[model samples]
Target: MGVTKPFPASVPLSSRAYIDRMDAGLTSVAGAQEIISMISSRRIVTKLILGHNELSDNGCIVLFKFLGSAIGRKYQITEISLNSNSIGNRGLLAISDYLQGNTVLKELFLQDNNFSEDPEVFITFIRALNASHLEVLSLTTNRNLSDPFAETFLPILETPHLRELHLSAIGLTPQSGSPLVAYISSPRCRLQTLKCNGNSLGFRAVKSIIRAIERHNFSLLTVELHANHLVGPVSSDNTSEEDGDEETGGPASPDAWKASETQIRRVLFRNSHLKRETEKEAIRLFRYARPLLLCSSKHANAPAPSTSTRCTDCSCSEIPSPNAPEPEPDTPASNRPPVEGIFPFHALPTELQLYTLSFLAPSLSPAQRSRIYNFASSPSTLPRLGLCLPSFSSNSRNTCVLDPASMPFGLNANTMSPGGGCAGGKCAGSKNSVLCHKEKQRGEWLAVVGCSAYDPYREGEGEGVGEAGILPETGGAV
Candidate 1:
């Protein structure tokens, strides 16, 4: 055996030792122990960077346990980086358990893991993380997941301390969408920032969560739902069976449906991803309806007379102009009507409505939304607009930017106002700040919401909707 070196004469305590910084980059998993020893020795070492190591599940468990138990809680180790590790779901689970009492850990990085492969593990981890004082959690670039994904996250929604949650490139499931939906609808979910990019979440799941937070409530300060299969580039004027969803179901909550649609409207309006097919679908539904819902002082009534082609009768001005001439009249137009019978608002199955809305939403201009009254209200004590629509501030990135047509992505940012910081204080000024400005700070928050949506393929992150919601032309109130 080689001669052992003598123990240090004066080892510094984690909380008392002073150091500018510490770089614990390990060449191998075997070196993580050395890192822990070094951290445990330095009583005041505030930051430790042991990321980019190929640590396995076992390695991660060992490191996190030692760090969280001693240096993490005993000495106030605020910053720790353990990214690029092959640590699977088990490693993450172990880390979560260890981090329960570590409050000084203000910044932690553990991205590019294998949690998505077992979504149930990810869901369980998040649910438990809700109870911890975790400010920021990033799980970007997870590859094992892709589509038909869903897992429980209501615990996170219910978490009182957590402010930001990042799950970009995480293949989403329909079942997972419910918690997100409940959180968006819940007034107590102290959710400030949520980012999910490059996943397989379809319009059905997206519509649910987005609807609950329609009209850009102040509670949801920062949101990033980007680079998914649901919204992608296609040939111009694309109209095929693939353009629609796989299936449709009856309405579960008429109020939730309306609420979700309005939220989608707001998102689409702010950043229109519109195309010819999307616009045509919206018009087709109106064509079949014949007359539109009439605006009333107290109660909603069927249309008494045609105002101006009703909601769909207006001319396709590049910008909404109330003064623009009306169409020849939908009544005289040939009756091709929508494929589904009855008006979408009254007859189409809820799931069908969701699909139709996803296809046609690119056409609903937020500028025109100003003309419609708050007729769709939920029984859940939500505002008349269901989710209160923030007043359109011209300077606000959350304001409407609906085009002459609408969005191809089916989402509208009209409701996502650049409101006060975050959905709640737990989000803003903390991890939420990181999410709100993630697009602008990808190099910084490398483990967050995957890459920025501005250009998923970009080197570093670019601005996201919350930071840079600037859209091409077409204006409307928030």
Candidate 2:
């Protein structure tokens, strides 16, 4: 009796099918072409995973024709994984044709193929990426990939939509690393994850990469630099020192940097075996480093704490006179002075600070008002405008107060009482020579009325208060 064969299920020609490993056991070109013919006739398969098959140029051409054809476009085939299949220049060239017109495909994995011999093939592939909507591309283990094709890949690397790039084990050196650093540094690049492990990128290249990350204000989440010849984790040290305060909201020192590197989940350097057990140690440090880089609630314009402007206990809040000496740098954390005030004004939100200032401004006397304005006009107050009330004029007849009754603009200097120092360029007709300091300070007499008079973000030193003596009467405000 003859054995009966199992019948194949009927699949609709109009329906989209998902095929995976259809050619795993089929090594013949004819067999691969037969599958492509069935796909073309049926107009099915939204995903095709045909890796590890000996599909050379002829088989690839057959697949590309169907994928690029008008009928193939209707099926919405969005993924194609053809890895380790002996694909070469001819096969890639054929696929490039499909990529030019195809907008539906989102991912392409052509890793471990043989397209590195001719540089033009990679160039052609780069051009194809420009026209395609492919978001993720992996060309791993193409060992011949080097500097000759670096220029060709830069545009693709900087592609705004290409969020993930995998080029591991591609024999890349500083030649390729230089251009890659440029690409990563560019604000145009939207890449969030970069895998360039197992390359020969040296320590200098890693330094360049770190500088780019900071200089460009990178938003990358993960970067793998494992199994490279990188001399050390020097990038972390440098970046930590440069951006430590900003990242950790703390001091700019090595400890803070190490703390930041451990806290922030931004970089990855697991297998950079530079010193003996160094990579392991770095990994261990980051693993145990408590995450302190929490999201801050301060307003965007609020000034961050720095050596010059640290006000831990508000001791630095003594408003400087127009002639006050330059402030000393903040002391070390160990030698920090004890707190004196019940209210931590430095810890308050900028809006709250402004609100408090507004309440305090109305109650101050005319003399006190002038002193506050003098303090607010200093360089330190520019960055913290939310606490400033107004920019008073340098006019000698100015009363500095918002009250209309004592307005000095229309009244003569001799009309006011002596205590008001309106005489001798002093307040309320008073001849208080001690309170009336010289007005030779630069940017000291700005007449603009509102907080928006000068932008703090713009560059300019509005005359520093170096070695100038503070008036005893206005010392508290200054």
Candidate 3:
């Protein structure tokens, strides 16, 4: 056996120590132990850099113990850099326990470590994150962050003071979409920079993030999505499908994805103060995804009507008094008779009208749908029609018109109402499968009745309808 040397004397402690790149000389736990002894004596080192030393968990644990001790608690460390040191979970757990009581630490760099060896230990470290004052946490390549670990960690990643989150190349997949989106879209999220480069987050994950950014008004400065599986060269027209080459692992018909991407780009690039490099990266990430095409004069806004006056002869109105005379030739169009067989739906009370329409909606015959479409679409009928239209909810995303003639995605009334049986304007469920039928119809009822003629996507409108009752360019049943 080789002769052992006496322990090295501890150097006088200062506010900072940069012991990086000393792997060739001091390559043992003895170095970490000396540093720990100095710290345990409350030597007042506020910054420590032990990077590139290859000091494995054994050496790191010495530092961890020093960090957790009562004297170590007296010494406030504001920054620590243990990158590329091969520190594993055991050392990380010790560090986590130390962090619980240490309040001054604001930055940590644990890149290229072995934290992924046991995700539970990393989770324990994350749990301690709530107690620490960390502003910058970089875990660039702990490849063990698979679906399970991500799910556990994402809920805890909502630290409001965390300004920059570097999660690039951590083995994230599409399964991380929902939780990630929920966190990014949350109002409490104050993260300004989110780096998610070099992961397998496909179109689904990208699309969800894009939608969340727009729908939830995310304020992130920049989101790095470089070198992932979001296969692009997206199509020109909104209708063209994405190429589904198995080699690239891309799916077909990426219109929705393209739309969402374009919207994200718009939001990110809207601010004029962003740096040129950030704008360039935004462009590069969404090069294939086109910007939103502006509508022409054909989609110009129309002023809504000033007043809504119900027609006397419309079927929705209660029977007129016998003494009421017919309208003179000079009567305004709003007082004229409605189209034949079309109910004066606007004449009824709002709630009663909605209930009546919902009752009639399930089994609308082709002829009835046509008549309803004609009356609702007419500019002359819009003044009165505006009175009864559903006030659209901002939260609803699945708005679709109930017209049988213009149903999208090849849908039709036959498919919508398989076994129609609304004989007396009431959609009473049959006895055999009443529960199942009612459950199925419940979704459709909400979809149809909750839709509004003023929806942003309605064919004739520029964007959204206001209270002015301006008729859209395209009119159809709600």
Candidate 4:
């Protein structure tokens, strides 16, 4: 029995402790207990590396038991490495139990351990990992994990948090390749790096893997398949009709393998480009959609308008100024009706809202844009009309004529202005009518109806038109 050295006091409490292969004697159970006790005492230790120390099942049990204890739970250890430690079924079961409730641990490296001694223990450990917060798991060089590995571990591919997986040098055969192909081809696969080197994968299996990677997977960055049985004659028993040339039952040509590899490289390169583009597009979309999201969130949280107090009048005579103070509601603010047009404005789907905003973004000024956003976000009961265009009839002379009934008030041909500037006669003196600057330059009539309150027949209004009147030449002789 080697004497165990005391853990260095000079090491900071928060720093990772690398005690693997240090000759500090962690091979025996007593040595493992001492080190674990030391680690448990320092609650700040976040990473414990003890690979290649030959910590057999006995020693690992002591370490894992300490990890599962109430006192061990206090340590902020996010990572633990115990590779080549000679750990067996008991130690794995202990680690599996520890992992079930552990949320802080993100990485666990148990490569080259004695997991093959009892395949059931390996399966149990993997199942426990599905519930844990582990992001990176490396279980390489644990031989004889052939078909069972595929059956037990394929479901773990759906785990959202797992990003990198290393299962190289495992005793995986061609039979284990199809399941791997299926899992990697799935949309739920989030693995970024996959290393499966030094396995007994044949040409068909490697080809299938390449095909899946090229066709379905865009997230995998690195796929290592070195030292595998990629070249050589494939057996008909191992092949399916999907191989296209399975009837021939011969080795895949060198050109075919080379072409597959080239396609893989091209596809991976494309994935990289697509990933960058996707990130850029996401950021751009978020920037553009932030206002809409905020508006939606505010609307969602805002009190539902009381139907009893809802204003039936949806028309707004005038656009309210952004700075204008909202009038006090007859009922409480919670019971107050939403502002005019707000219901329809917010009724649009989020995508449509984004589309509308993007379409109007180029034309709207900063102040105007801000006012629009404020109107969407604010719960004010101010009446405001959304932007709309009025329909008008045009003559062969390129003159615009307004419909009499379409006007806010009654109109006759005599009341129509000789100058074809606005649809409802000359709007030069009308406060509610605004002339289109662009149309005015071209000597054409175009009127933007600001409000529906402009009545020509009012008491203080100008002279009324008679019934027996002819439309003006500029008014298109209506």
Best by lDDT: 4
Error of 1 at 112 (Å): 1.0
Deviation in angstroms for 352 in model 3?
A: 41
Whole-model lDDT values for every prediction = 0.46, 0.52, 0.52, 0.59
Reference-based lDDT, residue 120, model 3: 76
Candidate 1, residue 435: the lDDT equals: 37
Q: For residues 113-141, write the lDDT of model 3, one tens digit per residue.
A: 77754567757787788666677888788
Predicted structure 4, TM vs. truth: 0.60
**lDDT (tens digit, per residue) of candidate 4 on 382-467:** 22232222222221123344434455565654455433335444444233444433243222110111000111122323211112
Clashes of each: 39, 18, 5, 0
TM-score of the candidate numbered 2? 0.47
- The Cα RMSD in angstroms, rounded to one decimal, for candidate 1 relative to the true structure is 21.9
lDDT for model 1 comes to: 0.46
Q: Clash pairs of candidate 4?
A: none
10 residues in a row with least lDDT, candidate 2? 446-455
Per-residue lDDT of model 1, residues 299-402, tens digit only: 32223222222113122223222555533443322233444655535344434533443333333332211111111111111111112225432223332233
TM per candidate: 0.43, 0.47, 0.46, 0.60
